[model samples]
Target: MTVIHNLGFPRIGKQRELKRAVEAYWAGELPQGALLQTGKELRSRHWALQKAAGLDLIPVGDFAWYDQILEWTCLLGAVPARFEHAATADVDLDTLFRMARGRAPQGKPAAACEMTKWFDTNYHYIVPEIQPNQSFRLARTALLEQIAEAVEAGYNVKPVIPGPLTWLWLAKGEAYTQGATDAAKLDLLPALLPVYQDVLARIQALGIEWVQIDEPILAVDLPAVWRDAFKGVYSSLQQGSLKVLLATYFDGLRDNVSVLNGLPVEGVHIDAVRAPEQIAAVRAQLSAEQVLSVGIINGRNIWRTDLDKVAQLLKPLKAELGDKLWIAPSCSLLHVPVDVEGEEGLDAELFSWLSFATQKLDELQWLRALVDNKVDATVEAALEAQRKALKTRAESPRTHNPTVAEKVGKLTTLQRDRAPFSERIAAQQARLNLPAFPTTTIGSFPQTQDIRKLRRDWRSGALSDTAYEKEIRAEIERVIRFQEDIDLDVLVHGEAERNDMVEYFGELLGGFAFTQNGWVQSYGSRCVKPPIIFGDVLRVMPMTVAWSQYAQSLTTRPVKGMLTGPVTMLQWSFVRDDQSRADTCRQLALALRDEVHDLEAAGVKIIQIDEPAIREGLPLRKADWDAYLQWAVDCFRISTSNIENDTQIHTHMCYSEFNDIIEAIAAMDADVITIETSRSNMELLEAFENFHYPNDIGPGVYDIHSPNIPDQAWMVELMRKAAKRLPAERLWVNPDCGLKTRGWPETTEALKTMVAAAKELRQA
Candidate 1:
């Protein structure tokens, strides 16, 4: 019989129990014990779900309350000096967050671990700090406990751990890591290997069959030295009693396939979801003794698998490997949401077309059964539902708008900008009548649980539509008051109306399909179920104007209407593979163009359309960068073209590494651009310096992601550095992104210091 395995399960519970528990623990409403209890309950629930779905190998050690990478850091004891002391005791969740976000609990000045987006995904992870002279010791006790927990719960679990190569690959630079390269950090691994060996020995003693070692770095371009290191590391690891299944996901292992051929590891898992062409090559290349786990299910998407197509794709591989071929998700099920069955508010037709985590497992299980000739009529029925969903999506009126397509095709480069920056600035100043050295937040305030619950309740019909609108409006009013109190120059409605920057737009636009539970992990425990763009996208209604106008009604400060830009919305969504991304992006731009004009007509003086993901979505290879950037830049221009020159188009980017595409960033031609720079100490602005960005700019003065209150003096020093690099009149003072991740007290204190710092700069 073919084995069914999961690389990892989603840690956040079906109802987002982990998020609620974590927030409650932080709020002091729940204790640490309660948080741990919630984790246990979630883990048990996940195990039960996977078992009921008939998985042969349910994974342990992959569940993390925070992040798997951080767990790897803790396991190896490669923590920076700051977190080392904290981990000396049992790793507390609060201490972990403190280390990750940089909160100083004991009066020590907080230095947060650097955070960056995880591989083109919106999720953020804590970058492990490894000094050049760093040493690692095996400290994988936490992982051991998880294994014990699973065994104690009566499940024979496959323990999951990040492979050595991926662990080092995911780490930040030593100057960033406080100074360590893998070569300099090599001594630490010698100490680290024993703990992993011991853990394997312990599992073997407990009669555990297999352990999954994930080395996803194999998909990326690697140095020859690293390949040699992989050979040496696995050779040493082969001493362990438990069999190793080295799993590689996300992309194809092209050149690196031979590196695994001679390795002592028992089995290897490949991601067939992304690179299906590699299966034959991998099968041909692997030694005859090796067992191949084919990842046939689409873990990252909501579209139902055509079982016949998957069965056909796998038949040849199955013919070669027979029962040796294990069927698994392309990567981890953590990327998918738990259940589509619970989504009552979604379009019934669209819902039928989708599969969440539960559905996906069933799909894989049934596919294996089909191959084994054990599938029932239920399998046939499910396949039909998928076919119907695809058909409905393709033929539905929701998928097209002739007017929107025509508008996109007609757009010129001139639409990218109404006028040059110098003229636009003068025009904008005249229209808005705002003070100098403007201060405004990106968009969102904290997404408190009550707000989430209210939205959920309203969606489920537990709360009346009127009640939901009243609650959201009340939140907007509160935010407007707060901004006024801070004396901000430009204001935002706090984005309480939006569940996500991109999802909000997708919900308003035509030709978008939402899945009942199509979730993909952004990073750690946070997941985003992005709405799918199946066809041409267009805006039929004003999405943000009503909220912006309402917020404006409460303030004299010029409120900036916010929207996720065309390129960002396209990049973030699961776009149709058939359409040229440029064509689709242009369609979205045309849709947003209507909204820009609508906001302008509503008397909103400034419109800040955020395109944070634009630079991130760039192709990894430098060879293909320009083509992607050109269309991306043009899309932004087309979207904002309908607005008048004096309307003052502003854009905000968060967690951006804006080095390579400085010219493309310049080409977006927004009058003002706010970028996240606080954590990097204005270092991210080097691209702007090199390119000589002529637009008014805001490089965030303080890291808003952290709850630590930055002193006014700290912001003043950052502004002082920024002033040297940027002309003063062209500089705007703002927090890095939104204050959504922060509590109100911290947000208020940080902004107060930020405002004071700006005031001091003005005096200077």
Candidate 2:
């Protein structure tokens, strides 16, 4: 019989119970014991769900209180020296959260460890910090406890860990000397392998037969040295009694298959969803005894599996491999929501075309059954229904727009602004009349508990529309008055009427579906429910003009008409897969262009179109980047460039390395751009300096992602460093990103300090 399995499940509960529990613990409402108990309950529920879904091998150690990477950081005894005190049993959660998110507890502050994107995904992981001569020990209590808890519940479990090679490859440190030659951080792999060996030995003693070691870095191009290092590491690891299943995903292994074939592992898992051509090549290299886990369902998208098509693809493989074949998802289900059955009020037709994490598990099970020739009547009905939905989706008029297609085909270079950067800047300055070192926020204000409650009540019909509008307007008025009092140069309306930057606009646009429980984690305790774009995207009416005009009515200062950029809206949402991404992005750009024209007509002088996900959407390999950036940059320019010179355009990007793409960013040609830099201590400013970037720039003065506030003097110092790189007159001062996730008290004080710093620099 073919085995059915899943790589991982969503750790956030069906109703986001984990988010609430984690927030309560941080707020001191819930004790540590309560938090731990909630974790155990979630883990137990998930494991049982997987088993009841008929998974042959249930995965353990994928559940995390914060992030799986941070768990491994602690397990390897690589806790940074600053967090060493909290690594004990009593305050482990404190240490873990501090590493994931910097914290200030009892008037003492700890800067957070660095965080970055997880290999082209929106999920963020804590970057491991290592010294030149890093040593490791087996800190295996957490993994062992979770595995034991699952085993006691009477389920066959396979423990999972980030492979030793990938872990060291992802780690950060200065160069070190090994023997007579100098080597990078990955050279410490020799020291890291013994710890893995010890952990595997202990796991084997627990009666666990197989372990899944994930080496996702193999999907990228590897240096010859690192490829050779994989041999020594796996050779040492496979010496134990445990069987190792080497897993790779997100892309095909390509030429790395040769190195993989030489490894001494019992099984290999490849993502056939992303790179299906790899299937035949990998099967040719595998020995008859090696197990082949084929990923047929997409782990990154929300579409229902075309079961008939998948069966056709897998039938040939099953005939050749028999019981040695394992059916699974292309990657972990962590990228998707928990279930679609819990969502209500969706269009019946559209709902039939969708699937979430739970439904995907069932798809895997049914696919395995079909391959084994065990499909019963119920399974057959499901397969038939799925085929019908796919057929309907392909033919539906809802998925295409003739008018939008014609407009996209007619696009030309004439859509770009006629004026040069210098002329536009002068025109903007003449109209706006701002300060030398102006101060502004990126976009939003804090979405406090009361504001959230009011929105929820209004949505539920408990609050009248008239009353909700009055409340929202009062909040906006309060924000405008506060900015006036602070004497900031530029202002924002606080965005109290919106939910998420992308979802708010998505709800108002055509060709979108909203969900009630489709939450996916962006970072620790931060989850985003991305909207699904199912068809032709068009702007039916103005989305942000009313708010922008109302905000401008209260202040003489330039209040930016904030909007999420087209590329970002497309990148962040679950976009349609049938059409080309460029075509979909063009449709979104045309929709945004209408909104931009509306905002300009409303007398909003400054408009910000945030494209934070542009860097996130870049291809994993450098060779494939040009084509993506060309269309992406074109989409952004198409949305913002047709405005008047005095109507200044600003864009914001956060948490990405801009050095390599500085020229591409320059091509967007917005009047002003703000980016996240305070976390890197203004190191990103070097790119702007090197490029002699012509447009006005805002290197963020404070890190909004952290709770700890910066003093006025510190802000002044950071501003001085920025001034040294570029002319002070060309600089804008702002926080790294939006203030949506921050508390009101901190937001107030931080802006106050930021304004004061701007004044200090002006005097200096």
Candidate 3:
């Protein structure tokens, strides 16, 4: 019989109990003990669910207070010099909170670790800081405690964690990160391996049989040194009595499969759903005695599995390998919502075609029974349900719109090409003469509690449409006055009427679905409910024109028409898998193109099409980058071009490295581009040092993600660094990203200081 197990599960409660508890703890209302108790309760509940699902080995150490990578940071005792942790009986929860949030209970703030997307997923993890000669000790005992907690509950558990090579590979020191010499970090592997050995020793003492050591980096194009280091790292693990299951996901091992040819590991898990072609190559490397776990379920999106197709594929493998074959998800279920059974009022047909974390578990169980040729009544029902859902989705007429398809087909280079940058900039300057280092914001402003309540009341029908519009207009007026008072050169309506950048548009557009509660964690306690794009995307009327018109009517200052770009709307949402992603994105681009035309007609001077996920949507392998980048750039251009030369199109990208895709970015041809660089202190300017980017650039003056405010001098200094790379006239002063999650006071002060810094730059 084939074994069924999960790599991990979503830690946040279905209703976001962990986010509420942790946020309350940060606000000083809930005590640390109470917050910890909530975690324990959630863990117990989750572990019990996994056991009831009939998993062969329940996953432990998958629960995290903040992030799994940061959890490992504490476990390795790799605390940076700025942070000071205390000793606790269990774990230093306070210190862990401080490192993630940058505040230590009433004390001075330490700079939080740099955060970035986790390997093409929307989830964010705190990047580990590894300095030169960084030594390690067992700093955290939470993993061990969780293991014991699961064992005491009478469940056989497999402890999952990042391997030493991946941890060091992801760190940000001299040799720790990519594009650097791996020799330095590889040399420290000798010191790090003993820590792993010690950790495995404690886990082995718990009577656990296998440790799922994840090495997702092997899926990427890795340096040769890092590839060589994995062998020695796992080879040393042979000293322990426990068996190790080396897991890699998101992509195949590619050439990295050769390194594991004769490794000492007992099992290897491959993401067959993503890279099934490499299964034969990987199976060739494994010995007959070793177990091979095939991740056959789709873990990234919320789509139901095709049971018959999967059974056909796995049955042959099951016959070849027999009981040695294992079935699991392509990756952890952390990227998806917890359960779809609880979701109500969504489209009934779409619901049938959906599968959340809990539902995926059911699919995995049925897969096992199907492969074993033991179709009991329960498994048969599941198989039938899966078959019905797959059939309905395949033949649904709602998935296609002839008009939208015609529009997308008609789009060409003429629709994408704009006026030359030199001519367009001169026209823009002639229409609206501004300062050398002008000040502006990315798009949104602070979305305060009152603003959230107003939206809630409107949605619940407690507030009439007239009243809602009145209140939103009042808020826009206040925002306009605030920007004017702060002397920001360009202004936005603060997006007070919007709920989310993507969801607001989805609500007004065709071929989209919304859920009552479909939350996925974006970063630390912050969660995003992504829209479901199930059909052709077409906005019937304008999405942002009304709001932009109202805001512009309130002030003479240039008010931006804020819109989430085609790529971001497609990348961030649970996009339909029926068509090619490139086609769906092109459809979205054609739809948004109509909005750009309307916004320009409404007298909105500058329109921002936010494509922060462009880099996030890049293919994992370099060989596939050009094809993806071509469509991505074309989609952005189709959405942004064909405007008046003086309309001044702008785009914003945040928290992603641009050195690799700089040319594709330039090809988008926006009049101005703003990017997040404050977290790295203008370090991202290196992208511009080589590439002669023609258009204007704004390398964000301050990071808007953090609550810590930088003064005018700090903003001036950052702008000065940017000024060195490009001419003063080409530099715009703006915050790193939107201020949706921030409080009003901080947003006000930050903008005031930013405007003052722009003045200083102008004077210089």
My TM-score estimates for the predictions, one after another, are 0.91, 0.96, 0.98
Q: Which has the better TM-score: candidate 1, or candidate 3? A: 3
Q: Which residues of candidate 1, in runs, are more than 4 Å off?
A: 83-90, 103-109, 173-203, 376-378, 384-398, 411-414, 429-436, 447-478, 513-529, 553-556, 574-582, 620-624
Tens digit of per-residue lDDT, candidate 3, span 39-88: 99999999999889989899998899999999999988877667755433
Tens-digit lDDT track of model 2 for 56-106: 999998888778888898788787777655443433667777777777233
Top of the candidates by lDDT? 3
In Å, residue 600's CA in model 1 sits off its true spot by 2.6
Q: Mind sharing the TM-score for model 1?
A: 0.91
Q: How many backbone clashes does candidate 1 have?
A: 9
Residue 32 of model 3 has an lDDT of 83
Each candidate's number of clashing pairs is: 9, 0, 0
TM accuracy, model 3: 0.98
Instruction: Order the numbered candidates by TM-score, best leading.
Output: 3, 2, 1
Q: What would the C-alpha RMSD of candidate 2 be, to one decimal place?
A: 2.5
| Per-candidate local distance difference test | 0.78, 0.86, 0.87
Which 10 consecutive positions of candidate 2 have the poorest summed lDDT?
A: 174-183
